[model samples]
Target: MDNIIKANQFIQEGKLEEAAKILNEAIQENPNDTVAYVNFGHLLSIIGEKERAIAFYQKAIEIDQTMATAYYGAGNTYYDQEMFEEAVGMFKEAIANGLVEADAYFMLGLCYYNLGNLPHALANLLTATEKNPTDIDAMFQYGLTLAQTEQVDEAISVLEKVIKLDENHADAYYNLGVAYAFKEDIEKALASFEQALKIQPGHLLAGNGKKQLEALL
Candidate 1:
């Protein structure tokens, strides 16, 4: 089997040390292998060695300027370090290099969201959902973004879709309640909040929202 493939299997098995050994050997044997370098970078990032992971990813990029995975790996490492600007640059490069996948778009959206660039975040997150309609997490985040931007009706629709995707998502239910409240649909808001509490008994926000709406009635 290929050394990188073996290392990946070891990684999946939670044998980090073994994966490291195989990846190191693979790099030594074929120093120009961009895939091996990116995999090693990913493993190192998982181990919280962010700086070293960035170095390996940069090495991969150096070997192949068009290596999209290298840029994506570096983007994730930068994001882990809270370097949103660097992450944005790396993610954009990854996209430019043909990494037009939902995962990449989702990460880029998160980076923009963190950087307080709502418009960019919204655009990227919408693209992510278009790429993978079944991604509940992405859909959920997009709904929150819409709510934050005061697009209450649209937010409600998206949050409803999230609930359909995962009936037990307390956060989605809670946010749906918030959207309903914004539109003065008190009964529906109260019901959504109650459903959220039923799903997650300790949901403080939902509990508080239910109380506030009840007081109004």
Candidate 2:
């Protein structure tokens, strides 16, 4: 419990290095403590050492095959690295291993989107949004995927919902502008671009959108 307590304190203080040190020592002292390895992996991830994090997570999984969190972490690491196929495989394995979480679905959606598997991405993201409708990232990503698939109306609806939920969501407004432009609704497009610019001044995409709209006007 000493190591665990120290690790917790380090994490709470944002001392990820100290936490990883303590967790690594704990793992060395007790290699069977898969939780320590998993937490260490998570700490490494926070510090942006993705490959090391994946290795740590894999070590935990090797020691305890039933460590679903390890699989989930590995999946996220793969996804972050843009290894969509591998990420998809790992996330699916996590789900099959009963690692049910809104985040898992969200990650799966992202992987599918990156893989250009629009239908699967849409389905997974729909589940994520349903689980946590307030998830700004999920809503924005889902809307983007919908727009990519030519569902401009649906994309606008989702992006609008995101903007309503998080008024400062500049990306949502920017994407909504794109959706409106795709739908040939110049007025709505202009309004959405303005909204984005108001929230995030100098937002390049929104600025470009405004410029393009002005030309048409």
The best candidate in terms of lDDT: 1
For 98-140, candidate 1 gives per-residue lDDT tens digits of 9999999999999999999999999999999999999999999
lDDT per residue for candidate 2 within 1-217, as digits (tens), equals 6888889789889998788788878988998888898788878887789999999999988988878888998898887788889889889988888887778999999999888899999999999999899898998899999999998889888988997898899999898888888888999899999999999998999999999999999
lDDT of candidates 1 onward, in order: 0.95, 0.89
Error of 2 at 11 (Å): 2.5
What TM-score number comes out for model 1? 0.97
Query: Would you estimate the TM-scores of all the predictions?
Result: 0.97, 0.91
lDDT assessment of candidate 2: 0.89
Model 2 error, position 175 (Å):
1.5
Q: Candidate 1: global Cα-lDDT?
A: 0.95
- RMSD (CA, Å), candidate 2 to true, equals 1.8
Query: TM-score of the candidate numbered 2?
Result: 0.91
